[model samples]
Each structure stands twice: as structure tokens, then as C-alpha cells.
Target: MKNSIAFSRRSLLALTAGVLLTGCEQNTFVPPPPRVVEVAHPVQKTFTRYLETTGNLAPINTVDLVARVQGFLQSINYKDGAFVKQGASLFTIEPQTYELQLEQARAAEAGGQATLKQAQLDFQRQATLVQKDDVAQSTLDVSTATRDNAQASRRQAELNAKIAEINYGYTNVAAPFDGIVSNHLVSVGELVGVGSPTQLATIVALDPIYVNFNVNEQDVLRIRDVMRRRGMTADDLNQVPVEVGLQTDIGYPHKGKLDYVSPSLNQSTGTLAARGVFSNPDHALLPGFYVRVRVPFDKQDALLVPDVALGSDQAGRYVLVVNNDNLVEQRKVAAGPREGDLRVIESGLSPDDRVITAGLLRAIPGQKVDPQLRKIDVSE
Candidate 1:
């Protein structure tokens, strides 16, 4: 009985010790492994520096089509809003009346020519008679005066004929250039140009369009400085390449060249007016369209990171990075223009810093992370 009790007590002690050891093991904490994150150094690239601004697309030419002759509208020769070539007839006034007037002036010119010829013959005959002493000098003088008057009348008639022809030509309204014409402002049979020049329509040239924009004074100074450094003249400045894009475009797809730059800045606006000329063969661009403009001035190496990796908060734009200690950190960055899916880091970022490109949600600032170093595919 003593041996049985001793054995039972020893077993009980062992069981209690085992239970306490198990409790201790359960109470002890084991932290989870650091969250896995993908990190990469910023991609270095040679990117062209650009001056970006917003602008409006304008036609290179806009002219008001008007009637220069007094007449009733005869016929409309072109469809409303149709694109017409230079000198293509668009409207016809009462051409018959102008044509008749031109013919009348020509007839008067012919009569004057006949009269001048007769007077010249008479003057020559009288001069011959006087030289032969067959007629008096007075007769020769009268013939000479008659000849001069006839000559003057002939010149007057010729000028009148020319004027009449011009009026006749004005009876037909034609496009002054290749452009799209606005709708006709007058109906057929409407009397136009009776008192003053009447506006019939407007024509706008579209191809090789103009883009008007303004550069802030600061940008103007910057551009001028760059030009000076490059030893570029004012004409060379016009050769700089410009790019444009519509609001819906992904980037600047339309290409052009700097056509004009204002010599002075506007005091009220504090901007320098600028313009670019682009070949718009398809006429996809129109007048008064808001567009984005960019002028490339310089090219240099820059650091870029995935745009998705950027974040924003009260501290402005920021990104997550991993330090040499494999700890996550938040870095404030001055963001620049976007290149593809990446963004240029203008300031506040080091080339060697490992930016967190993926697994951002799991990467908490001030916490250790298992950084998986990877190469950024810039092409992607």
C-alpha cells in the first residue's frame, strides 16, 4: 500500500508539471514573419524636359466673305458649310446686270477709239495741209485740239470699261482661299451690297492649324535662359519642336513647331503669348478647341518610379521605400511629369532608395519587411 501511494503521488506531480509547462508554452508569443514586399530602385532614364501649358486651337485664317457689288442674289453656287478651293465660286449676284454694264462700257470704249482714230487722221491731214501751205495754222491747231480731246475721251472710256469689268467680276462671289465656308447669310433673290458691303458668309482655313497659348513670365525666362545657354537665336527658338493633345488623348500625339513668340509679356496677364503651327491634314483639329501643349527644351537623365507607387496625404505626395535595414519608410517626393506608367521624381528622392512597388498594403511604415528586390521593367 505504501509503494502504491508513493507511485500515485509521483505520477500526480509529473502530470501537474506537464500541465504547467503546456500552459507556459501556450502563453509565450511568436511574432509573425515580416510581410513580404517588392522593392526597386528608381529607374534612371534620359527624358526630354518640356514646358507644358494649355492652349486653344485656332484656324490659320478666318475671312469674312462679303459682296462687293450691288445686285440681287442670283444663285448659290456652293453647299452651305462646304469646303471650297481658292477662287471657287460660292455665290452669284445679278450677273446679267453687271455683264450688261461691262458690255456698255466696252461699246463706249470702242466708240471712243473710233473717234480718236478719226481725230488723229484729221490732225495728220491738217498738219500736212498746213506744211504744204494749203490750209492755215489755225485749222491744224483745231485738229490737234480735237485729237487731244478724243485721246482723253478714249482713256476715260477705257478706264470706265475696266471699272465695269471689275464690277462684273464682283457679281460672282468666290472663295479667297482653300477653306470651309459658313452657311450663306442671304437667300436667293435677296438684294445685297445695295448700300454697304454685305457679309455673305465666313471661311475658315483648317489644315495647318494654329495653336495659341500663353507662357507664364517665369517659363519665358526659363526658356530664354536655356536658349542663351545653347547659343540659340530668336529664329532658332522658332524651330523648337512642340507637341499637342486633346483632352481625351492619352498624351501629346499631335506634333508641330513653334511658329511665334511674343516680344513682350502682357502686364495684366503676366504671360507671353505664343503660337504653334501643326499640319492637320485630316482636319481633326478645329478652331477654338482647348488642348494641351508641350514644348521640349532640354533633355537629361532623371529618376522615375512607378506611378502606382506614389501616395498622397497631408504631407503632400509621398512614396513607400525600404531602407538598408529592411524597414519601411515614407518619403516625401516632388513629382514631375509622367512618363508612361512611371513618374519623374524631381526632388526628395535618392537613386539608391528602394521604393515599394508592390505589396504596399502590407508594408507599414516603421515596420520591418521582407523586401524582394526586383528590376523595374521600364518598357512595361
Candidate 2:
């Protein structure tokens, strides 16, 4: 009877221990939520959003040097890659052949002039002869006709000589404008004539360089709307202009004017070409360089947030905004132009709203969280 009583007591003790141990295991297995940081948004206006693109640089003027008259290249007048002034001689062809032609034409013209003078005198004599009856009517008529024929021949010869003079000048290849010339295609003694299809060299005007880029036709309509919104007159675009950017640097070095926008959209590209002219007296902007361009529209004030402070959901875009009670409120936002890494909010956010960025995954709508404020790393 004593043994039975002891066994019942042991069983009861084991049951109590098992129940206490089960409760402790459940408590130890539960995980606490993660901590998150956020920042308060201050309402302010910022003016610097840029339209980016890759553009190519080019000279304002490009010319191909061609020989007007057929002749053997006698000499290269200018050094290869030399800067030439307008009307500077670049090459010289064999002038001997053209010179001979000119001389022969001049001699023919002189002989014709002498013949014309004699004809004038003979016509006068013939008129006098018919009136004084010193010669027959038929004889006077014959002399007059001969004088007229000689006069016509002299005029033709004078025209031929003038043409010859022009051909002689063509033997010297003169620069068309002030520019840098390319390397010589033919040596001094090489043959350069009508048979040669390409130009002997090329010249490009580098000063006051131009940058060319393309923009979508849809953007064209928007630009025009901006111009009208600014109360711009027809002449205003000539005075006020758009600025450009370069990939060589992070931002545009200097401002430029919108010089050209294509009248019609390119059919193949479905875009229009735009050109901006900038003074490149320092030659800092070289020709044929690919660059990025930025143009500002107008200043506007809007709610904005750093890219890090936002999250993408199946329901478009939303952010975990913190309320005064530190509760996470999922607010849907309309995004606008991205200025650097920040997004301009078009709607759905107010001033001084704290947004959770770093620990976004740890947040849920209506969940309470510990709000820690932090700044973005500025080194990037």
C-alpha cells in the first residue's frame, strides 16, 4: 500500500514538469520584428532636372576641295592639316597648258579686233561710194555685208578669250573659307583632274562648333507648348534658347542656343534633328565626339523622395510612410521626372511625411514600428 502511493506521487510530478517545459519552448521560438529607419520630407522647389542623350559634335561648315579644270597637279600649295584663310591657295595644277590656251585666245581676239576696225572703215567708204556714184550699188552692198560678218566674228572671239581667262584661274585651287584642311590626297606631282571622283582634301570650320542630336517628335510638341506657356513671341526663340549637355562632363560646360530644329519629323527615325550652337573658341568641344545633352523646361515645385525611399509592389508604386503614432501607412504615389536619384512626386504625399526606405521588407500597412531617422550617403 505504501509502494502504490509513492508511484502515484512520481507520476504527478513528471506530468507537471512536461507542461512547464512545453510553455518555455513556445516562448523561446517566437521572433521579434526588425528595426527600420526613415526620413521626413520638407517641401521645397528644385529647378534641376535634365533630359539626357548621346550627341555628336560637328563643324559649322564642312567643304570638299575639288578641281574645276582638268590638269596635272603641279604643286600642293598649303601644308597638310594647315589652317587656311578664305581665298588661300591650297593646290596648283599645271598652269602651262591653260596659260597657252589663254595666250592663243588673246592673240585670236587681237587679230579679230584689227579686222573689226578695218571693217568699220570699209563700211563707211562703201556708203560714200554709193552716194557719190563712184561704185555700183551691187559693189557697195557686197562691201557692207563683208564688214558685218567681220564684226560678228570679232565679238565671238572676245567671248572665247574671256572664257579662257576663267579656265586659267581654275588651275589654282583656292580655299573657300576659313577652316582647318585635311591631309592631302595626292602628292605634289600626282595627277588630279576630272577623272578623280573624290575631292583632293576636305576643310572643316571648327570655331563656334555645333552639336547635333535627335529628339522624339512627341517631345517636339511638348517643347512648343513650353514656349507658348512662357509667353514667347515669334522672335523670342531667337533671343532665349535651350541649354545642352555633354557626356564628356557630368553637366553642360556652358549654355547654348537652339539653332536648328528640323521642319519635319524623320520618317525612318520618327524623330526630329535638333542642333545647338556653342562658341568653341578654346576648341574644347571637338568634332565627331559623342556627348549627352540636357535641356531645362521650367521651374516647378513638387513633393519628391530619394529613390531609396520607395518600393515597387504588384499595385504599381507605394511607400511605407510613418504617421505621428509610428504606424506604417502604405501610400500610393504618382511619380514624375527623376532628378538624379530622387523622384518628384506628382501627388499622394504631404510635407514632413516620414518614409521607411532601409527596412522596407519589415514594414506592413497599419503595423507599429520604431522610427529611426537617417541621411543618405552623399559619397555616391
Candidate 3:
């Protein structure tokens, strides 16, 4: 009985030890699973750098027509809003009074010519009498003076006739250019050109429209720097090509050339005024309409990454990159304008670097990750 009791105690101690070891094993800690992240290599391509801005459409030429002479407006020769050719009659002032004045001027001119002819005849007779010593020298001198005064009067009368003719021509108002004319400001038979030059109509050229825009000083300086690197002169700025789109249009569809750049920045707005000329043959672009302008200045090979890979902090913009060993690394990046779904990686990333595009929250910097390689649509 003593031997059997000793054997049972040993078995109980072994069972107790086994139970304690099992409890310790159950309490031991196990680490969580590794994070999963979608990764992609940065895309390299020849990217075109475009400066986009907004502007307003303007006419190449706009003029407000005004009467040049005083008269009652006889008639409006043009239909309202009609396209007219250069020198087409637009309005008519009363020509009867001008014509009558012209007739009186001609009659005065005729009388002057008759008086001049009589004076010439008298001077010729006096010269003959003086040569023959049949007339007094003082009398011959008086005849010469009278003839000279009559000649002066005849010339003055001729000038007065020309003035009358010009006044008569001014009665008919004509268009200064080929353009669309606005509605007549003065109705027929209304007194026009009274006291002040009366507003008659307005004209605007349709084809080859102008687009006006303003660029900030910073952008202007950047563009100048770019031109300097290319050895371009100030004259070459007008050669830069520009593209424009209307508010309803999707992309820049109308192509144009930059023909104007301000010599100095505006002090009030800190912007430089610029203009582009577009051949708007269809008259699709009208003055005062809003438009989008894009100026392409340079092209270069650049690294592009998915926009989802970017993150922002107090340090500005940053992106997560996976190293060759599949370790997550946070890199601060210099990002540029967005190109579709991708953002331009201006400085920070290399073409071969793998960027974490998804599951970024699951991945921690300095930690290992199961990076699932994926392709980014650079075209997007």
C-alpha cells in the first residue's frame, strides 16, 4: 500500500506540471498579419507642360459710328444688325440745303471769274497805253493793282466752292470698314449732329477675333525663365501658340497665336495682360464671351504617379514608396499639376520607384508589407 501511494503522488505531480505548461502556452502573445498594399512603378513619359488660364473674347476691331456734319437725319440706309461692306452707306443727312449752298458757291465763283476777266482786259489795255506813253504811270499802276486784287478774289471764290462740295459729300454717312452694324441710334428725320457729334451706330468686325487674358506676375516670370533657357527673345513670345475653348466646350478646340504681351506688369492687379488672335471664320467666338486658354511652353520626360498614392501633412505633399525589399518608405514629393487621374511627380520620385497607390492606411512607414503589384493607366 505504501509503494502504490508513492507512485500515485508522482503521477499527480506530473499531471499538475503538464496543466501549468498548457496554461502558459495559451497565454503567450502572437503578432498580427503583415499589411497589404497596392503598389505601382512610376511612369515615365514625354509630358507637355501647359499653362492654363481663363479669358474673355474680344473683337479685333470695334468702332462707334458718329455723325460728322450737322443736319436732319434723312434715312437709315442699312438694316439693323446686318453685315455691311466698307464704304456702304449707313445713314443720310439732308442734302438739299448743302446742295443749295453749293449752287450759290458756284454762282459766286462764276461772278468772280467774270470780274477777274474784266480786270485782265483792263490791265492789258493799260499796259499797251503805258508802252505808247498815252496813259499816266500812276493810272497804269492803279490798273495793275486792281487786276491783282481781282485775281485774289477769284482764287478765294474757288476755295469756297470746294468747301461747299465737301460739305455736300459729308451729308451721306458711310461705313469705315467691313463689319456688322448695330441698330441706328437716331431715327429718320431726327435732328442729328446738333451741337455735339451724334451717336449714329456701332460696328464690330467678326472674323479673326481677339482673346484677352491676364497672367499673374509669378507665372509671367516663370515663362520668361523658360524662354531664356531656350534662347528666345521678347519678340518670340508672340510666336507662342495658344489654344482656347468656349465655356460650353470640353477642351481647347480653337487654335491661335499669341500676338501681344504686356511690356510691364499692372501695378494694381500684379498681372500682365496678354492677347491671342484666332481665325474665327464661322463667327462662333463672340466678344464678351468667356473662354479657356492653354499655352504649351515645354516638353520633357517626367515621372507620373497615381494621385491616390499622394498624402499631405504639415510638410506639404508626400507619397509612400516601396523599396526593393518590400519595405514601406514615406517620401516627401514635389508634385505638379494633375494629369487626369495621375499627378506629376516633379522631383521626389524616380521612374523605377514603386509607389503605394491603395491600402495606404494599412501600411506603416518602416514596416514590411505584402505589396500587390498593379499597373497604373498613364493615359487616364
lDDT of each prediction vs. the true structure? 0.94, 0.78, 0.91
- List of clashing residue pairs for candidate 2: 247-292
Q: Write out the backbone clash pairs for model 1.
A: none
| Candidate 3 lDDT by residue in tens digits, 75-94 | 89999999999999989899
Q: What's the TM-score of each model vs. the native?
A: 0.90, 0.74, 0.79
Please identify which of the two predictions, 2 or 3, would achieve the higher TM-score against the true structure: 3
Each model's number of backbone clashes?
0, 1, 0
- How many clashes does the backbone of model 3 have? 0
The digit string of per-residue lDDT tens for model 1 on 143-190 reads 999999999999999999999999999998899899999999999999
For residues 59-141, what per-residue lDDT tens digits would candidate 2 score against the true structure? 99998888778878888888888888999989888899999999999999999999989988988998998999998999878
Error of 1 at 281 (Å): 2.4
Q: Which stretches of candidate 1 lie over 4 Å from their true place?
A: 1-14, 25-27, 121-144
lDDT-best of 1 and 3? 1
Residue 163, candidate 1: how far off, in angstroms? 0.3
For candidate 1, give the lDDT of residue 164: 97
Model 2, position 281, has a per-residue lDDT of: 70
